[model samples]
Target: MTDFRLVIVSAGVSDPSSTRLLADRATQRVSSLAEKRGHTVTTTVIDLRELLPELPAAMSSQLLGPRFTRAVDALVRADGLVVASPVYKAGLSGLFTSFFQVIDNDLLIGKPVILGATAGTARHALVVDEEMRALFAYLRTLPVPTSLFASTEDWTDKALGARIERAGRELVLLMESGFARAVRDESWDSYQHSYGSAGGTELDIDLSSDMMRLATGGSLRDSDDDPFDPRRA
Candidate 1:
């Protein structure tokens, strides 16, 4: 059986939050679907509320502590992710956004992500599509076509369950197909646009160009025997 790791990030603040409930429902469905497809799935859930105290340090210092690091590492190593947040001010939670802000930009590139959101009313449902999707897009993650949004009333609605199953199925199919892995393996170098990438340099510059030559203090052709001698004017 294929081994898969799934990470669920729930940005719920309450003791028994609707956001976490929605995330749990999605994770259960995805796990079931993967099992049906002959894959063994392991899941890790990160509740951002628990890490709230460390967020300010992470954001300001741009460094993650051991606890926060472990959470981000789980996300980096995950084959798929279910990210859920509670909507505030008609958008995603600030805590949710801050948690992601400390992670490396390239960490989630080409990874499959299932976006979810919860709010008090259906009027805030579009936050999943507009806000959450845009955030994952910026990270270069492949968010499934079916996004899940749960309002307070949706907790008892059968249609919410159906949508959860649909979104879960899409995530499972993508994981089974190995689409994210293949893309990361084949085109990773092309996506490297900053330091510490596998490519060693940004892709936009040509190392052999005149600008690069000048930047590197000219070519290695001018070799003077005297160490103290300057170049002849």
Candidate 2:
């Protein structure tokens, strides 16, 4: 059996928020699905509300403290993620966005993510696809095909449960198939730009490329006299 690590991030503010409820349901469903597929799943839930005080420091310094660092580490190491947040004024919670903002841009590359959101009105359901998907796309995370959005009315709707299960199954399948790891191992470097790479150096560039030759005005050559040539440097 394969071992899978799943991290659930709940960005709910209130003590008994619907956002957290959705996250819990999603996590449980995903865990159950993974178990059924003969994979052992270990889940960690991070409540962003608990780290509110530290957020200011994290945002200002652009650094994660010990507690938040541990949370981020869990996220980075996880095989899959369930991220849920409450919608406020047609946008995601600032706390939710702030928590993610401090994370390294490359940390979530190719990780499988299941996006979810809770709002008081059904009109905000699109927040899951429009805002949350956009955010995860920026991080280069592979969000599952199904996304869950829970509105006040959706709690009593049986369809909500179906959607949750569908999303969970998709995430479990992605995990079991090892697609995330394959993408990360094979194509991650191709997706990443040389600047600010994880190793703190640019990828090897071909000076013979038309772009490089044009940028150097065709003056750069392979000889040692060409100071701009990386080989000479």
Candidate 3:
């Protein structure tokens, strides 16, 4: 038996939309697969529509206020990730891109992700196949094959159900495969090297004794507030 967790995110702007369909199908696919493997599965859905948007600058470094930070924590610990979006202009939705761009550290790195998308016609279905896959690739997520996609025309049809079922089986194989490549088994800190990485070098990491990390609490350095543990000027 394995432990699996899935975070289905739909960064759709509309109130009643097909993006949720993509997310829901992905969730169902994972659920069915978990049953076959006897894996304990937990699911969390982050509907960007429901989340009040924080400033772009605040989340630009993977430190997404409180809500997204916790979401990151969960994704980092999960065995699986399935993310979907509504393609716009041959690419992912801007809302989804914003969510993706801000992450300094992709918590789901090395976890298997099922890339999915819903669009108006089959013409853009390939966007799901190409764009979302590349996005996950950039995040270093293991995007599984058999992407579950549906254009507006196919949602209610019987073939859609069959495709979803097929995707479910693929997801099962994905879970088994991802379990063997778990990143936690390796040192996470090693991945932190390289230019433009979060917080830069060790010197960039200011070790303040104050018990605050985010601007929401207070500024890291305030002329009025006494600063430092005396170890560094």
Which candidate achieves the best TM-score against the true structure? 1
Clashing residue pair totals per candidate (backbone < 3 A): 0, 0, 0
Ranking by lDDT: 2, 1, 3
Q: For candidate 1, what is the TM-score? A: 0.85
**Candidate 1, superposed: residue stretches over 4 Å from native:** 196-216, 219-233
lDDT at residue 199 of model 2 (Cα atoms): 26
Cα displacement (angstroms), candidate 3, residue 140, comes to 1.0
Worst 10 residues of 1 by lDDT: 196-205
lDDT of each: 0.85, 0.86, 0.68
Off by over 4 Å in 2: 193-233
The residue pairs found clashing in candidate 2 are: none
TM-score, prediction 2? 0.84
**lDDT tens digits, residue span 66-101, model 3:** 676665556655667677778787677877877776
**Model 3 CA lDDT for position 37:** 70
- The lDDT, on a scale of 0 to 1, for candidate 1 is 0.85
Minimum summed lDDT over a 10-residue window in model 3 is located at 198-207
